[model samples]
Each structure stands twice: as structure tokens, then as C-alpha cells.
Target: MSVELNKTLFNSRLKLIKDAWNNASDSEEYGSIADVGAFLVMAGDPAGEDDPIRKGTAFQQIKGGDNPIAIEIIPQAGAKEPSNDAIPRFVQAYISHSRVGSLLKETHTGKLVKEWEALLAAANSRPELVEISPAMSSFMAVKDDEELKIVRTAANLTSTLLANYIATKLETILDKEAKISHEDFSAQIEARLGSGEGDDAKGPDMKVWNKNPKLKDVDWGSTELCYSPIIQSKSTASGYDLKSTAESSPDMIAHSGVFLISTGIRYKGYCANMGRTIIVAPTKEQEEIYTLLLGLQADLITNIKDGAQIRAIYQHALSYIKDKKPTLEKHFVKNVGFGMGLEFRDSAYLLSSKNNRQLKAHMILNLSLGFADLVDDAGKKVGAENATILTEGVKSVKDTLFFEANDEEELKSSKPKKPPVKPLTNGHSASPVKNKTVAGKVLRTKTRSAAQEEVLMTTAAKIREHQIELHAALQAD
Candidate 1:
């Protein structure tokens, strides 16, 4: 079965780009708009196929590998005909004859960089034609309902694959005294993804779009991974640095120690991310840190809402970490979370100390919070690579989408009362209240003990105390 392209979604996105172009052209801040022609040009495949700007503007996927393709969006003044819609007319794709076959002449078969250079030359000659890449990035950061649904589906697939891998295979693999390579683990994951069994067989057959040729008859489901599976064990998971390539040494997955598995999958051009740090034979410090990390992630989710400033959110996480475990502050990843949709991470809406953009409804975020460089009682470097003792999945913010926070009072009033502290048989805290919408479903707040809640409330109060200062700092930016 073939996947149908959502033309309406693409059309609405095109309208956003066109509107941004017109707004920029009219504004004096961009420069003189007299006779200058502004064109949004993006190269494909080995060049810019994965570019969010191109993805947002072009409805159809352009598969350009050795023979790359380029797309140009020129904003027109008005529709030539009375009834014809002008949005579709603005987009023009330039695919090379090598890729498109002999129907079209081989006019643009050269390097995509040269084509881009030519566009750059034209832009340099004309001052009014500003680079609208940033504008496009900003516009595409917030997803619409249809886009959210696709991303949610992709996220659900990833979650299922990850859950299945952990439940069925991880223990057996980790239990064996024999060495297991990262490639072996990654292959296992790929097998599950491409199994084409049961519900997995329902969708179009998966294809890695960038590496493979464009399907002639139908759009194949894109399984091109958003990033290489991160399978780091033992000392490898001790630090914050990410390993994309497979480790050269064998026995990457040790019999004991912490193991980190971060993986993402792409479906129909959109991406979803999920990660977990598995610990086998974890030390007391490792388990404590793991539980702490989970709690921090939960607190971060509770604070997230529409209209919240991205930087402020980061500050909140930072402040919470500092108040709870100051030593781990250095080990924490620089970014708390980021906006994700067409691209794995939308740069325009990064949840960093520097970004001041407000979070909006329909925005999906990958909330990443973890520690590294952990030391044991004797100060030995034993990483939380994989822990099986507290094997309950850490409720970190994976692929989460926000819904409209139109009525704060209503939301506050509807907040479910905290249930009595009931520990699970597995010794994990009971599931918390489901108050927020995420990934097209309701996401619950992380469960916290009375003491932990007291600490969090104290931290929140402290943050509230500095709200004015934080607001001032943001305004200064």
C-alpha cells in the first residue's frame, strides 16, 4: 500500500512561507523591495533534501542522491486567473535529468552546490531579496493538527519498537556473559522495525528515502532513522558526549553496567525520538541518580505549557537541578528540550538559555534530561549504561506535543487530586495524575513522594520568587 501525501497540510505550509516572503519584502527592515525578486531556493538529497525549509514548502518528497535536485519558491503578486489558487504555482522543483530520466533535458545535472552558489550570487546582486531560511524555520516549528497526527503515529511506532525490544530481547542479551556489539543490537532493532508482521505490515513497506531511489508508483513509508541508534555501555555511557558511529572495539554491550539506547524513526518525512538508559547490576549511586533523573524530567513536564518561555523553562530545570543536586549540574546536558517536527530538532524553538521564544500549542518537544560522569563511593568511574534492577521505564519526556492552554483557571480547577502514595510491587512510585495532553493523548505528571513533592514545591516557590527578575532578563534579550 502507498502512503498518500496530505496536500492540504502542504498547501497551508506553502501559504505560510509565501505570507512570510510577502511580509519580509514589504518591510523596510529587509531592504528596498522595488524591483527585486525574492526566491526561496533549496537543494535536495546530498545537499538540502532534509532541509526543513524545502520539506515545509514542497509537498512531494524529492529523492536526489548522486544527481541532486533543487526547489525554488517564488512569491507571485496575484493569481493570473480569477478562480485559480496561487499557492501551488509558487513552488517549482528542478530535478536533474539523471534522476528524472530522459523526459526532461539535462540542464541542471551538475553539483547542487553550484546551483546554490548561483542563487547566492543572484541574492548578493539584489539587496532586497533577503534569506528567508530563518523565517521558514520559525514558521515550521509549530505543527498543525494533521502534522501532529503523523508525528504522533511515528512516535507510537518508535515507542512500541523500543518497548518490545526491551521486554523481549534486552535481558537475554545483557544476561549472556558473551560480548555483544552495538551493530548486533542495532540490527535487532532494524529487524523489529522492518518485521512487516501484524500491524507493522499494515502500512506501506518501509524504505530509507535518502539512500534509496524515489518510488515510481507510490510513496513508500520512510524508515530512514532520524539518527543512528546510540548503544553505549559501561564507560562509554559515563559522559555526556554522544557516539553516532558504532564503537570499533567489540563487547560494546558489557555483561554489567549502564547501557544507553537512544533511537528515533521517521515515517512519511516526520520524525519521532525515544531514549532510555538501561542499568544492569547498578550500584546504589547509579539507581539513585537514575530515579532522580526521572523525577527531574517529571518536574520539567509539569512546568511546560503553552505561552511558557523556552529559556525560562530551561532556567527552571537548571534551578531545580542546582537546588537538588548541584554537583550533577555540570553533567546535565546543555539543552533541556527542543521543538521537533519536520526536522529532528527545530532550531528556532530550542529550549536553551539563549532562546526566548514562547511555546505554542501543537508544538512537539523531546525533553532530554540526564546525568553523566557519575562517580562511585570510591570515586571509580562506573557509568549508568544499563540498569536492570530499577527496570521500570524512566518517564522522561520523549515525543510530547502540547495542546491549547486556553483557560488556565479551568485547567487548574480540573487538576486531579493527588492520590494516596501507593508504591507498586516493583517498588516504583505510583503513576501520577494525567493532566496534560501529549502526542495526541493525555500525559500524566510524574509521581513524587510527599518529601520529594515538598522539595519540588519549594523549588517552584523559589522560581516564582524570581519570576520578576527572570521576566526582566528575558525582556532585556
Candidate 2:
């Protein structure tokens, strides 16, 4: 997308926030039923992280510099006319002049404080500086047409990178004789994005967990680039606590076993998360668990819709897992997913029993579902013990649109297309198969070894079957 188009979209986003503030002012929930509206101040993240409120209203390119950037939205009586083609007239951006070459660059820190104080003093009736963070969250939960387009693009880019570049070349990249180090492999992925393969938007770094049990506690210093890729191959994925520093062990990619790659790219400040587990030489138990998780994920996605209670959806997922695989119930993640947009994880609409928010149309969701601390039938820990799939989707009024590594025909067509299921001679269901083309080129080619090829083929078949099942479920709904 062009910069001009992005500016126009930014205007639309600001307008949404402005309208949200006005709506909150009229409602009794914010204690503004008296028709008195106060100035809403949104502060930027001081650490220059991806702040939802600031980025949602203003340009995505703008960030916290020497000082915290602030945006003040004063509720106007009537719909104000746009002063320019870019920024909405209601938004007053306070950015430092040092942020040169930035969108909406201005130096209004001194004026912002003075105006805020003066407005408070001049009002005959005291108006409360109501916390509008809730309003902002509500406004950002549902994406507009422009934002959705960016998110879709980001999703496609991520799928293409993972399915085409990474998966296709996995055998060669992780060859036992000439295995690439975790850090080097991460760099290659980054280099692909830097070379016009993906957007330049900022978000969480790419995570490459090779699933090696040896380097579980190695903590490399944080002297790498701001978006340096995190490489860990321990029993569990790194940053599971969501507060620890992202560190990668100086370990090479494992020669065989489960390799989990969870990554996403920020396109125009919108994030798209895609995680896949690649089992080099899988065991029967490994294949069964992966297929089971995929089916479970498909069921969860099918149940998501607009107007559904967030907690209800989560509970449904929990019940589905419990009923399908009683053993994996305790291993399921606490939260199924959460709203995603300008910020990587939007806390306003978390898909958890503790949250009371309802799913709204046009809401972008990142569904992270899987079983951790996995074990085999022999009560022994297995490779890829922490099996998880992090995929994104957009919630619609009727059916949700999940971003997947499938052909365009599968994605665009609503009709349920029967997959070619070749039954085994033993009268059992066909084996799992990986996706043929993820966003474009063939995912698995003849380059892989025969055993590896069979595994991927089975993986692709299972993906297809689940997709067909998902379509059938949607049709039934």
C-alpha cells in the first residue's frame, strides 16, 4: 500500500476513536451522562514499543522519541470538517521536533499542557478526566476495511515465507552434515524480510525453537538488533512467561525431530502470527498429536463468529478438547486467543473465561492453541513436546476468515470442495498431508528424502481434510 493511502486510513482510524469518545461521553458507564465531555489524553509508550492507542489514532510510522508522544482528542459538539486530507481535525498530536521525517511531526509539548490546564479552569462544571483507554480498546478491536487489507497482506506474506522459503528448504538447511546454527537460520529469515519480502513494521521478533533438549537454559545477552530473531530449542518455547528477555542459545539446528517456527511480520503496523511445527522424522505418536491439534484448531476456528461471547468461545474450545482428548485437556493454554491489531496482542478482547467481552465483526484474532509438556504412550517425553499452532483470522458476522497456507481457490471459495482421499488398503482413513501450495509455490517438493516426503505428504493431506471439514462446518452453520 502507498503512504498516501495509509494516511487516509489513519484519518479513518482517528475518526473511529473520536466517535468512540463521544459515544462514551453520552453513556452513563463513563459517568458522562450530563453531556459534559472532557479532553481524552492518550500517552505513547515511553520505551518506544508498539503502543495501541497512539498508533491506532495517529500514523503507524510515528514512535516515542526523546519524549513520550501524546495525542489529545477533544469531543466536539458537531461532526467537525476535516482540515486536511490526512489527519482528522479532532486529533491534536504532540510529537517532538527531533522525530524528523516522521508523519505528523510537531513540537507542541508546551502548548499541550497549557491548553489542558486552561480548559479545565475555564469549564463552569468540573469534568472528569475520564479514562478513555477502554473506549480506545473498543474502537481498535474491530478493524476497518483498510486495516483489514493490511492485516491480510501481512498474513499472506508470513504464510508465503514459512511455507515456501522455510518449509521447502528445511531438509537442506538442517542437514546433519552441514547444519545451520540457530542464529544463522534466524538471520536468513530476517534477511528475507529485509529484502522486500515483507513489511518493515515493528513487532515481536521471530522465534525459532529447534527443540533441542541440551541448551534449555542458555541465555545470550541482549546486544543484538532491536528485532533480532530469538532461537531456542529447549523443551518449552522461550518467553512463555511473556515478561522475560528473548534470548537464543548458541546451538545449531537439530539434525532431526520437531522444529517449531513461530513468526509474524508487521505490515503497516498490523501483525499477522503464523506458527508451524516441522517434524523431520516423526514417530507415530508425534503424527497423531499434531493431527489431533490441527483438528481441534479447526473446530475452534469454525466456532468463532461475531456477537459470540469471548468467554463462551473459549469455554467451547476447552470443552471440545476435553471431550476429544481427555489427556490433553490440562495441557491446553489458559487463553485460546486474543484480539490483534496495531498492538501484537490486544488485551481488551482476550478469548478467555475471565474476559466478558463479545466478539465483534471485523475483529482480528490470533488463535494460539496447543498442548505443552507433551508425553508419549510410554510415559516418556517426546520431541516437539510443546506442540502449538499460532494462526490468525478475522471474525465476520457469519463465518470467520482464517489465514492459512492453502491455495487461493481453497481460501476464496465458500463451497465445500471434497478433498481427494485415497484410502489405505487396510480400510483406514488416508494419511495426513501437508499443504501443496502455501500462498503460491509447492511447499514440499521432490527434493526431500522419501521418508521426509511421506511425512510431509501425510501432513498436507491432514491439512486438506481439516480444511474440508472446516468448510463443511461453516456451511452447516
**Number of the top candidate by TM-score?**
1
For each candidate, what TM-score against the reference? 0.59, 0.58
lDDT score for residue 40 of model 1 = 36
- Please state the error at residue 382 of candidate 1 in Å: 7.2
Q: Lowest summed lDDT over 10 consecutive residues: which window, candidate 1?
A: 468-477
Q: What does candidate 1 score on TM? A: 0.59
Cα deviation at 36, candidate 1, in Å, is 8.7
Query: Residue by residue across 1-477, what tens digits does model 1's lDDT show?
Result: 444445565567767655655675564322222223543344334324433323333223322111223244344335364533223332222211111111111123334436444554544232233344345455666666556656655665565556546423555564344456765777656654455667645443233212222223222345556665666666443342343333322345665555667677776767777666654434446555665665665566656766788889988888887888898787666676566666676666667898877776666776667554556667765334522212112432211111233343444566543322222111233334344432222222333453344334543333333321221100000
lDDT of 2: 0.47
User: For residues 270-345, could you state the per-residue lDDT of candidate 2 as single tens digits?
Assistant: 6666555555434555545555555556566656766678888888988987887788787777787677766666
Candidate 2 stretches greater than 4 Å from native? 1-36, 43-128, 195-231, 234-245, 376-477
Report lDDT (Cα) of residue 202, candidate 2: 42
